[model samples]
Target: MSASIAARNIAGVVLLGLGLAVGSTGAPAVAATTVHTGVATQLGPCPTPTEAPGTEPIPFPLTSSVKPTDTSTSTVIVPDGPQMQCSTTAPTLYEDITYSSPTTGGVETDLKLDLQIPDTPGDKPLVIYITGGGFITADKSANLGQRTYVADQGYAVASIEYRTQLTGATYEDGLADVKSAVRYLRAHADEYGIDASQVAVWGQSAGGYLAAMAGATNGIKRFDIGENLNQSSSVQAVVDEFGASDLAGMADDYDAATQTAYMAPGSFINNYVFGPGSTRTVATDARANRAANPATYLRRGVSAPVVMLHGDQDQIVSPSQTLTYLNALKAKGVEGTRYVVQGANHGDMSFLGDPDAGLLWSTQKVMDVITGFLDQKIGS
Candidate 1:
C-alpha cells in the first residue's frame, strides 16, 4: 500500500485498538476534535502571587532551586549518541543563588546555581535559561552542552528549575510557575552575583512559551502581582524556540494523531494544562486559564525586544503558530528578530555541527540576540 494508505490503516488500528471505532470516510474529516476523558496527572501546582499594592518593598527570604535532601536521579542526555557527554571539560563558574516567593510561603527552596561565566564578562550580560519537556521532563543538567557553547561568547549563564512538574495543563498554572521562578531570581539578586535588573529569559519548546509570555505580559495590568516580586520578574528580553504561543489557536489547528498523543497520559501540557474544562473553553473551571494564553495577551505598550527561532518543518508545533505570534508582535510595532532554521525539525541536533563556525548561527544565535539585548539594557 502507499504511505498515505498505510498511515490510514495504522491510524484505524490504533484508534480501534484504543477502544475507539473507526469513523465513516463518507463525510469530510475535520481537524478539530472533542476529547471526553479524565484528568492527566503530572506535577503539582505552583503557588500564586498576591498583589501587594501600596506596601513597602519587603525583603522576602529567598529560595534556591537546588536542595540538600534532593538526589540526582539521572545524568544529562547526550543528543548525538550514548557515549558523548554534554558538559565535562567546559569551564564553570559558581554563584551563590537564592529566591523567595509568597507561593512557597516565604521559605526559600535552597537554590545553588553553577554559572558558566566566560573569561570576558564585563560587557557580556546573562541569559537566565529554562529548558522544556512539556513542563515535566528535562532540567538544567540536560542543557549542559548548549549552555557551555553560549558561555564561550563571554556571557554569564545560569540554568534554573522552578517547582518542576507543574500542572502546566493550563496557562494560569503554567505561567504562575514561571512568574514565581523569575521572582525568585530577582529576590536573590546579590546572591546570583549578576545585575538582576539586566536579566533576559530564554527557553526551548514549552520553555520558549513561558519566556515569551513573561516578556509579552510584563507590567501588564491583568497578570500583575501586587508585590515587589511583580516588578522584579519583568524581563528585558526574550528568546523563544518553537514553543506554542497561542493555546486556543494551536489546539484549533492540531492534527488528529498529535491530538491523540495530547489526550493520552504523560502529555502534561495538553492533557492537564488544557483540554475539556480548562480556560480554552468559555464555560471552564476558571477564566484565569484562558486568560493565561500569550497570544491573547499581546498588545501595544512597553513591549520588550524578542528573538524567535523555529524549524520550518517542525512536526510538533506548526510554523503557522510562530508566524501568527510574530505577525501580532510586528503589528504592535514590536518587530521581533526572527530566523527560521531551514529544513530543520523540532529540536534536531544537526545544527550543533561545525564547532569552528561559532555560536552566531542556528539556534545559538538565540543566545546571541539575548546577549545583545542585555548589553543594551544593562551594560549601557
Candidate 2:
C-alpha cells in the first residue's frame, strides 16, 4: 500500500522557513522568519553561501519544490526504505560495543553501539544516531552512511541499539536506553577520542522521537538507569526530523484519507507506543498522549538547543507534529528552530529512489543547516 494518501496534484504549495525564539517562563513568543513562498521551482546544487558555515543560517532558501506538478489525476507510490543519508565509505571506529544490558521480565538483552571516527584528527563532537524501525526493531547497523558525512565535517557518529516493543519494552524503556548510551559514552570519552561535552542526538522518524525525548528530559535522573550513573546523559544539541511529537494528536493531524490509510494495518505508532486497539485518530483533549510526550518534560534551563526539520508534504508524519511539539515548547519559554522542507516526504519513505526529492532534502546544503546548528551550540 502507498504511504501517502494526499492528492497528488496539489496547487500553490507554500515553501517557507521559520526560526523561532521562545524565552523562559512568562516571556513572549518571538520569531525571525524568511519565507520564499511560491510554486516550487528551483531544487538542485547547493547555492553559494554568503556567510561562513556553522552559523545561524538557512544555507538554501526554499523557493520552489522539486515535486513534479501533476495536472491530471495521479497516484504516487513511495518505495518504503531507510533515510537517505550521506555516504559512509569510511571504516568503523568501533562496532558492537554494548552500552546497556537490562533484564526485563527476567530476560536480558544486550544493547550495543557502533562508533565511526573521522579520518581527520582531534577529539570530535559526538552525534548519537538513533536508528528508526517503527520502534519494533532498533538496528544500529542501518544508516551507517550518515556517519562518514558527519565525521568528515569534524564529528564522530555512534549508532545505538535500543529496546523496541518487539522485545516487550515500553517507550520509556527505549528512552532510558538512549540515556544509558550517552552516559556510557561520557564515561569512556577519553578512551574513544570523544569530547563528552560536545554531544548531539540526531535521529530520523522514530529515532527523531527518541532524540527529542532525550533532549526534553536531559539530566533527568529517572531516565538514567544502569551504568555510569556518575556521568550525565544531557546532550548539547538535538536534531529531530519528522518524528512524532504527540502520539494521539498524530492521528488528529491526518486528513480523512490519510487517516484511513494510516489505520489500515501494521500501524507502528499505535501498536508500539499507544498500544493495540488504538488504530484511530484521537481527540486533542485526550491527555493520554502527554504521558510519553517529550515536550511534556521540557524545562527552560534544562532543555538543549534543538533544530527540527520536517517535510511539509509528508503524509506518514505530518509537519504539524513538529509544530505541535515546538509550539508546546515555545509556550514553556524554551528555544528552537524549525525548518520545513517543501515537497519532501517523511524520511525517505516517499523519496527513496527519487533523485530530485533527494537533492531537495538530503543534500550537502541541508546537512550544512544541521551541522551549522551543532557547531553553534556544541562547538564541534
Candidate 3:
C-alpha cells in the first residue's frame, strides 16, 4: 500500500486501541477464557450481559491468580480472594496508601503498595512497578501476586497506576501521575520504612516505557506541563521490558498482529508521546519528543542504571527496537544489562505458551533483575 494509505490504516488501528485501553465497562461476567488462576475479574455494573445466541457458556473461575492478603499493617487488610504465592516466605510489612496529583486536573490516581523488609537489618531497597497496557489497560490489582513475590524477596514494591492517552490523556498527564507517585513515596518513605535514597523503578511493556521515561529525563522537566515544574523524583535504577522507547520508531509499517497490538484500544504510545496525527509535533520542540526517548536520554550523569528485557519472537515491539535502544546506551559507555527470552512473545509469560522451550521467563525473573540491580547500586 502507499505510505499515505498505510499511515491512514495505522491511524485506524490507533483509534481502535484508544477505545479498548480501559478494561471492560459493564458488570463483570465469566469469559470463554479465564484471566489466569488467582486474579479475579473486576466488573462494574452493567444493564445486560451481552452474549451471542450461539455462543458457548462463559467459563467459571475467570481470573488468573489471586493476590495474597496484605496484613502487615493493621490498617491495611488484604482483600479476600484466591491469590498466587510466589515464594514460600510471607511478607512482614504491608501498607495501603493513596495519593492525589494535580498533574491531570487534580485527579487523584490510586496505588496499591506492598513494603517487604529483610530480617538482616540493612538499608532497604525500593522498586516501583508500573504494569503494562501500552499506557492504558493495566491496573494495580492485575499485578498484586507479582508484587507480593518481589516483596517476599525483601524489597519494597509499589505497584503504580498512571493516566494513559487512550482517552486523549496526554503524556504530560501520565508522567505527572508517575512523578506524583514517586514524590508521594519519597515524601512518605519513613511511613513505609524504606530508604528513599535506594529507590528503583521497574515495569513491563508500557510500564517499562513509563519507567524509562520517568528515569530518563528526571523530574518535572520530563513532562513539560505540571504544577511543581522543578520537582525531581529520580530513581536509582530502571528496568524496561519490551517497552516502546521511540515513538517515531512506531510510525514504521508493521505486520497485521503487531499493527493491531500497537494500535489496540488501551495503547496510547503514539498519542502520548507523538501527539495526534503522525506528523504532529509531540513536544514543544519536535526534537523534545525524541530527546525524551530513553535511547536519547543516555548521558553523563547519575541517571538510574538500566536493564532491558525482551523476547526475540516478540512481534509487538520489534527486536530491532531493543537493539537500537541498547546500542545508544552502549555508545554512551553507560552500564546496562539485557536478557532476550529466546522464543517468547512480547510480554507473554511463556514462549508462545510452551513449557519445554526452556526460555519461559516469568515475572519472577524480571523481579530478580530489579532486585539484583538495586543490590548492586544501593546494597541490600
lDDT of 3 by residue, 1-380 (tens): 33322222322222111000121112121111211122222322111113211111111111111112122211211122332235544445444444433333344343334344434355467778776655555454434445555665667777665676534466656665666666666666665567778777877776777777777655435453333233347777888776667654542235544444444333344466554445344323348557657766666565567777765544345545555666667777666666665444444322122222212334335445556666787656
How many times do residue backbones clash in model 2? 3
How many clashes does each candidate structure show, in the order listed?
A: 17, 3, 20
In order, candidate lDDTs are: 0.47, 0.63, 0.51
Tens digit per residue, CA lDDT, model 2, 1-380:
12332333232221111100001112111111222221222322222223211212111111212222221221222323433343333433576777777765568887788787665567878899986665666766554335455655777778888887666676778888898888888877887688998899988777888999999998788887777778889988899877888876554454454454434433555445554455443333256457678888999988887888877666445667777777777887777877776556655442222323433455555566787888888764
Please give the ranking of all candidate structures by lDDT, highest first, separated by commas. 2, 3, 1
The parts of candidate 1 lying over 4 Å away from their true place are: 1-91, 95-114, 121-124, 164-170, 221-231, 251-254, 260-267, 272-290, 348-380
User: Cα miss at 168, model 1 (Å)?
Assistant: 7.4
Summarize candidate 1's per-residue lDDT along 51-143 as a digit string, tens digits: 211111111111111111111221111122122122223334454343222233233343333455554434345676766654544344435
Which portions of model 2 miss their true places by more than 4 Å? 1-92, 260-267, 274-285, 350-359
TM-score of candidate 3 versus the correct structure, residues matched by position: 0.65
Global CA lDDT computed for model 1 = 0.47
- Per-residue lDDT of 222 in model 2: 83
- Which one wins by lDDT: 2 or 3? 2
